[model samples]
Target chain A: MQYERPKSLMDAASLLAGAKGSAYALAGGTDLLVIMKNDDFDAELVVDIKSIEGLDEIRETSEAYTVGAAVSCAALGESTMLKEAWPGVVEAANLIGSTQIQGRCTVAGNLCNASPAADSVPALVAAGAKAIIVGPNGNRTIPVEEIPVAPGKTSLEKGEIVEAIQLDKRAPQSGDAYLRFIPRTEMDIAVVGVAVSLSLDDKGLVTSARVALGAVAPTVLLVEPAAEAIIGTKLDDAALERLADVCSAACQPIDDKRGTIEFRKKVSGVLARRAARIAFDRAGGK
Target chain B: MSAIAVSTTINGDEVEFLCQAEETLLDVLRERLGLTGAKEGCGTGDCGACSVMVDGRLVCACLVLGAEAEGRSIETIEGMANGDELHPLQTKFLEHAALQCGVCTPGFLVAAKALLDANPDPTEEEIRFWLAGNLCRCTGYDKIVRAVQDAAQELRGS
Candidate 1:
C-alpha cells in the first residue's frame, strides 16, 4: 500500500487518476480505513487530501457558507457562523458519529461514502446545499441530494473530488431542524431521518419549506410533495398531517434487522411531523 | 514494504519514527514508541479504546494512519501524568472508583480530559454526550461520570 499526502488539488487528482491500481482518497478516514482493514483488502494508493491547503477551512460570506470537503464534523459543528446560519445542518453533521469519531469524520466523506442513513445528507438537502465538484472537467456545483444515486455509491465520476459544500444564506424568519429515529439513544445509524427547513411569513404561515427523508429509500429523498403540503399553510395540525402522509408515501425502504419496512414508513412521517414543528418553532412561530 | 519517516510531538516531546504506510497511529504509539497506554479493544472505530488527543482533538488513533501524524501533536494516556504526579483527572478517577475491569479507563480518562479542556463546567448531558464515544462494559459509567464532574470542579477551583 502507498500512502501519499498531496499538497495540491491538482496533484491529488493526478495521483488518483494515474494510480496503477485501486486508489482511495483519505478524507477523515473514519470509514475508508475500516474498509481497508477488512479481510482481503488492498488499495494501491491512499491519497491524503486533508493536508491540501484550504481544504480544512469553513468560510462564511454574505451570500453563503463554504465548508471545505475535508473539514472535520466536530469542527464544522463547532463553527459559530455555520451553527447560527444553518443550525439544523450543523447538528445533523455532528450526529454522524460520537465525539471521538466526529473528531475524524468529514461531511464530504459522509456524503461520498454514500450511506443511505447519512444524517447530514437529509439536512443538507433540506437546506439546499451544493457541493463544489472539481476534476478534469473543472468546477461545477451539484445539489447534495443528487450526489447519491444508490447505497455505497455516488454519481461522482472517476478522478472527481468534492472540494467544498455551500449552504446559501437564508432570508429572515427561516429555521431548519433534523431528527432521526434509532433504536438506541446515540451512536446508532438512523432507521429513519427527517430534516425540515422552513421560512415563515409575518402572519406565521410557511412561505417556503423543504423536507428530506433518509434510510427509507436507496438515497435521501427530497419529498417535494411533502414540502408543497406545508408551504402554503400556517403549519397547523391539518397541514402537518398532510405533510406526514406524503412523506411516508415517498418511502422505498427494505426490511432489515434494525427496522422493518412498515416501521420505517411510520417513523418517517412521525419524524417529519416532529422536525417540522421544531423548525417552525425555531422560525419564531407563536 | 517501505517505511515512512515522520516527525511529531508526542506528549510535548519532539519525536521521530519510521512506520509502515498502513500502520495506525495506535500501533506506532503502542509498538514503535513504547507508549502502550492506549489499548486496542476494537481495531475499528466502534470502540474508543484507542482514543487519543491529536492536535488537541479527540480521535480514535486506530482510524488515523501513522503517516497522517507527521508534524502533529499527539497525547495518549501516558501523557496524563506530570512526571511522577498524576493529573487531577487521573486522581479523581481513582478517588471515585471509576474503573472495575480497567480496560477502558485510559480512554475514558483521555476523553474526559478533552471535554474538561474544552468546557470546564459541562453539564451532565454534555459529559454523557462527549464520552459516548468511549464505551465501558464495566462500572456502568456512574462512577466515571462522578469522577469527571469532580475533576472538573477541582480544576475550576484551582
Candidate 2:
C-alpha cells in the first residue's frame, strides 16, 4: 500500500487524480479502518488529507456557516455560534459515538460514509445544509438531502471531496432539535433518529417547519408532509400527533439486530414528536 | 511501496523514523520506536485500547497513519512518569487498586490524563462519558472509576 500526504487541497486533488487502483481519501479513518479490517475494502493507495491546511476551519459568514471537512465533532460542539444558531447540528455531532470518537470523527466523514443510520444526516437536512463538493472540474454545492443516493453510497465522483458544510442563516425565531433512539447509551448506532426545525411568528405560531428522519430508509429522508402538518399551527398535541403520523408513514425500515421494522416505524414517530416538541419550545412557543 | 520519513515529538523528546507508508501510528509506536504502552486491543476504532494524546487531543492511534504524525506531539502511557516518580494518576491507581489483569491499564491511564488535562475537575458523569471508549473486562470498572476520581482530587489538591 502507498500513502500520500497532501499539504494543500490542490496537492490532494492532484494526488487523488493521479492515483491508480482502489484509492480512498482518508478523513478521520474512524470508518475506513473498520471497513478494511472487515475485509470489505481493497485499496492500493490511501491519501491522507489531514496535513492539508485551511481544511480544518469552522467559520461563519453573513450568508452561511462553513464547517470544513476536517473539522472534528468536538470542534463543532465547542463552536458557540453554531450551538446558538443551529443547536441541532451541534447535538447531532455530539451524538456520533462518544467523546473519544467525537474527538476525531468529522462531519464530512459521517456524510461520506453514507450510512442510513448516521446521526448527523437528519440534523443537517433539517437545517437546510449544503455540501460544498470540490473536484478537478470545480466546486459545486449540493443540498445535504441529495448528497447520499443510497445506503453506503454517495453522489461524489472520483477525486471529489467534501470541502465544507454550509448551513444558511436561519430566521430570528427559528430553532432546531435532534433526537435518536439507540439500544445502548453510548457508542451505539442510532436505531431511529429525527430532526425538526421550526420558524415561529411573533405570536408563537409556527410559520415554517422542516422534518428529517434517519435509520428508517435507504437514505436520510425529508418528510415534507410531517413538516407541513405542524406549520401554520400552534404545535398543540393534535398538531404533534398528525406530524408523528406523517413521520411514521414516511419510514421504510428493515428488521435488523438493532430493531424491528415495526419498532423503528413506531419509534420514528415518537422521536419526531419529541424533536418537534423541543424545537417548538426553543422557537419560543408554549 | 516507499518508506516515509517522519520527525515527531514523543514523550517530550524529538524522534525520527523511516516507516512504511501503510503503517498506522500504533504500529510505528510498537514496532519501530519500541513504545508498546499503547496496546492494540482492536485494529479498528471500536475499542479504545490504542488511545493516545496527539497534539493535545485524545485519538485512537490505530486509526491514524504514521505519516500523519510528521510534525506533531504525542504522549503515551510511558510518558506519564518523571524520573522514578509516577504521575499522580498512576500513584492513585496503585493505591486504589484500579487494575487486575492490567491489559487495559495503559489506555486508561492515557485517557485519564487527557480528561484531566482538559478539565481539572470533572464530575462522575463526565468521567464516565469521557472514558466510555476504553473498555475493561476486568474489575468491573468500579475501582477504576473510583481511582480516576481520587486521582483528579489528588491532582487538584482538594
Candidate 3:
C-alpha cells in the first residue's frame, strides 16, 4: 500500500485514475481506516486530498454556501453564518457520530459512504443541496440525491471526487429541520430519519417544501408526493395528515433487528409530522 | 509497503517517526513511540478509548492513519499534566473515585479536558453529552460527571 498526499485536485485525481489495485481517497479516515482494518479489505493506494487548497474551507457567497469536501462536521457547527442559514443541514451533519467522530468526519464522506441510514444525506436532500464534482474530464454539479445509487455505492466515476456540497441561499420565511428515531440517545444509527424544508408565505401557507426520508430504502429518498402534500396549505391537521400519509406510503424498508418494515413506515409518518411542525415553526409560521 | 517518515509535533515537542501506510496513529503511539496513554478499546471510532487531539481537535487515534499525522500537532493524555503536577481533572478524578479498572481513565481525561477547554462552564447535561462518546462500563457515569464538574470549578478558581 502507498499513501500520497497530493496538494492539487488534478494530482489526486490522476493518482486515483492511475492506481493499479484498489484505491481510495482519504479525507477524514474515520471510515476508511475502519474499513482498512477489516480482514477482507484490500487497498493498494490512498490519495489524501486534505493537502489540496480550498478543500477545507466553508465559503459563503451571495448565491450559495459551499462546504469543502474535507471540511469537518465540527467546523460546520461552528460556522455561525452557515448554521444560521441552514441549521438542519448542520445538525444532521453533526449528528453523524460523537464529538471525536465529528471532529474527523465530513459530509462528503457521509454522502460517499452511500449508507441508506446516513444521518446527513436526508437533510441535504431535503435542503435541495448540490454536490460539486471534479474529475479528469472537468467539473460538474449534480443534486445530492443523484449521487447514491445503492446501499454501499456512489455514482462517482473512478477518477471523480466531490469537491464540495453547495446549498443555495435561503429566501425569507424559510426553515429546515431533521429528526431521526434511534433506540439509544446517542452513538447509534438511525432507524428512521426525516428532514423537512419549507418556506411560508405571509398567510402562513407553505409556499414551497421538500421532504426526504432515510433508513427506509436502499438510498435516501426524496418523496415529491410528500412535499406536494403541504404545498399550499398552512400545515394544518389535514395538510400534515396528508404529508404523513405520503411519507408512510413512500417507505420500502427491509426488516432488520433494529426495526421491522411496518414499524419504519409507521415511524416515518410520525417523524415527518413532527419535523414538518418544527420546520413550520422555524419558518415564522403560527 | 514502504515506510513513511513523518515529522510532526507531539505534546509540544518535535518528533520524527517511521510508520507503514496502513499503521494507525494509535499503533504508532503505543508500539513505536512508547506513548501508550491512548488505548485501543474497539479499534473503531465507536468507542473513544483511543481519543486524542490532532491539530487541537478531538478525534479517535485508531481512526487516523499514521501517515496522515505528518505535519500535524497531537495532544495525548501524556501531555495533560506538567512536569511533576497533575492536571486538575486528574486530581479531581482521583479525589472523586472516577476510575474502577483505570483502562478508560486516559480517554475520559483527554475527552473531558477538551470539553472544558472549549466551554469553561458546561452544564451537567452538556458535560454528559460531551463525554457520551467515551464509555465507562465498570464505573457508573455519575462519579465521572461529578469529577468533571469539580475539575471545571477548580480550574475556574471559584
- Top of the candidates by DockQ: 3
Q: Write the per-residue lDDT of candidate 2 for residues B1-158, one digit (tens) a residue.
A: 67999999999999999998767899999999999989999887766888898888888898888888889999899888998999999998899899998888999999999899889899999998888888899988899999999999988999
The C-alpha stretches of model 1 lying farther than 4 A from their native spots are none
Q: Give the clashing residue pairs of candidate 1, or none.
A: none
Flag the better candidate by DockQ, 1 or 3. Answer: 3
Q: What lDDT score is found at residue A129 in candidate 3? A: 99
DockQ of each: 0.81, 0.69, 0.86
lDDT tens per residue, model 1, A181-264? 988778889999999999999999899999999999989999999999999787889998999899999999999987999999
* lDDT of predicted model 2: 0.88
Better of 1 and 2 by DockQ: 1
Residue-level lDDT tens digits of model 2 in A165-222? 9989989889999999998778889999999999999989999999999999999999
lDDT of 1 by residue, B26-142 (tens): 999999999988999988888799999999999999999999999899999998899999999999999999999999999999999999999999999999988988889988899
- The numbered model that scores best in TM-score is 3
What stretches of model 3 exceed 4 Å from their correct place?
none
